[model samples]
Target: MAFPGERSQPRGTILIANPSADLYGSDRMALEAARGLVSLGWRVVVTCSVDGPLVPQLRAAGAEVVILDVPVVRKSMLSARGMLSLGRDVLTQLPRMRRLIKDEQPDVVLANTVTLPFWTLAARSCREAVVVYVHEAEAALSGLARTLLTAPLRLANGVIFNSETSRRVSGWPGLERRDRARVVPNGVGGPPETLAARERLDDMFHIVYVGRLSPRKGVDLVVRAAALLRDAGIEPHVELVGSVFPGYEWYEAELRELVDELGLAGHVRFAGFREVVWEEFAAADVAVVPSRLDESFGNVVIEALLSERPVVVADHTGLAEAASGFAAAVLVPPDDAEALALGLSRVHEEWTDYRRAARSDAPRARRLYGPESFHARLSQALAEQAFPVPSPSMKDASWSPREVLD
Candidate 1:
């Protein structure tokens, strides 16, 4: 069945460009979207700025992986030097990308992140239709960076937001154009039924936080919350199952210091990056996402719910939307250690009830975010033509580095 805002199109070749080669939430969504397209008999090619862990996963999903040196303009790009560097990189790569697009001659080009809108702009000069998969909430973008990023979105034929939060945050040029932009929430596979039988361990309650260890992710807050729990006579074992990205070791060090200062070093375990964190979810009685920034979509929350584990999320931004679907989720104020501690205690005190609620609600949560539904919505976006796909123009003028830098 077609969703509210989609129309089916005949299958054809499509090129999907993502910013990174890592298998994070956005990367996984791109890969899954490629898989979904392939299932519909569409030939797919994927491109990334560099080669990393997710290349093999993309290949396994039957999509060709192309490594291109595309500059991903981050929030840091709002500065003069950063903008100059970004402009130079875009200018340097434009000709090569244009040639690549000409050679591939895809029917559609899917740019997979807000950081890489240059891909969509590149496709604007090609015969291909450009569709942007916005995985970020534009509220997180700096003013100048937001303007720069939103400029290219004006040229997109379609825009797919990972959540309503993203849609509202990103003031895309064509946001009011109903057929052009719509929301398609991220999807995840169902957990094994045996996960529902996870009883609280008598020795220690297992609390898990599975995401990047970064300042914005509030990993330090999770550690502080653990200390608060100890103060309340609850000695739960908090397992942090992720690591900070390279170049952010200082943040990781800070988190460690916070744990040490609280005298909860023995209570918290840092499990460095694991390719699959589902096992970590399965082992935990409670899952926590203490994010300081607005999350576009909370994949960890859904995973924990599917695993029949109660979730505790910061009560702000898209996190509330994510955890709101499940009754077992506990919401606490962002960055408040005492509140988080109380939340943890509440979950532990009502363990039996929360576990039962999670188990009972697991099927509904799984169905709401199942792969089939996501693919269905994605297919509709890919097939729909909100605006006419521009014909390839031989006289298309490339943007000057000066024009971009200015």
Candidate 2:
């Protein structure tokens, strides 16, 4: 298992273990972390269970990507039979993970999410430093499930949470006393130039929702909100710009049926999955994130703000934190279609104010969530766990913000 860039005198090596290869929120954050490590002159190798769109992006950023049969813990695998399967996977995959770590001789093993608990355990058994980057905040989990999910954190040398809400909800013992635990928000990339809101040539107000179409994401609420607007004589066109998980196809079907039931079949459009959503935001009068569950953080809200589009988001947990202090964003109660519709109506009535606020706040959003800030903070966090801080002379000459953002 020879990896590329086998250097005799590299500064250090880091192997990042991630659960998925899809280019979703956490997947994009993992890619950014790899780019950050590469910029710091570390030999970056990323391992995933399967390959998808994120593999090439990692390689292009100077990180090596390896596909392996990594054991991942999912919520559906918490049942009796599922627990047996998980135990079997741990028994079989642990040795391979240990061997890989021994072969790579990495300075640190970074488990990207709690789902890859086996990676942390393997690294510890090898006497290697390990860090867990947590991207989930499952408040709905049972007591037994939550304990099992966070048990791996005790073995980690350091832990990074995406938000304060996430860290608080985790409730892991000694986390408050731990010096290495930190909250680093997701770095979201946006269009090169912030485009102004497009003028409407017709009576239709375009709305866009850009994330997974699962029930937790509350896509059905978005559809129902559009129906409410129509019933009140406001013509709104809703575009859902993402798809569902592997087994959640039925949820998407239900959404479509709900649209037809509310007589919004002509108003709602399923735009499907998209890698780039700036064009969708450009065409939308407003963006909505109506998640029913607690999101660790809201990357899409930041994306909408960066795109200079007014946003309506469910105000709870990380979603509230993401939209906080952004005047262009309107917050409504979670899972309330009427409240969401009212928020959307408020933005429509005061369209001029919201538009100006969005344009005015675009630069601030860039300053806070841009790639440069994200890479700097993430690299520093990982570097601290791997080794001492590098001096100015040790910085990589080829490292640039443009390279990572691209």
Q: Which candidate ranks first by TM-score, i.e. highest?
A: 2
Q: Could you give the C-alpha RMSD of every candidate to the true structure, in order shown?
A: 6.3, 6.4
**Which parts of model 1 have CA positions greater than 4 angstroms off?**
1-10, 79-81, 140-142, 172-174, 192-194, 386-406
- The best candidate in terms of lDDT: 2
TM-score of each: 0.90, 0.91
State residue 384's C-alpha deviation in candidate 2, in Å.
1.3
Tens-digit lDDT track of model 2 for 248-296: 9999999888988988888999999997889999889899999999899
Worst 10 residues of 2 by lDDT: 1-10
> Which residue pairs in model 2 clash with each other?
none
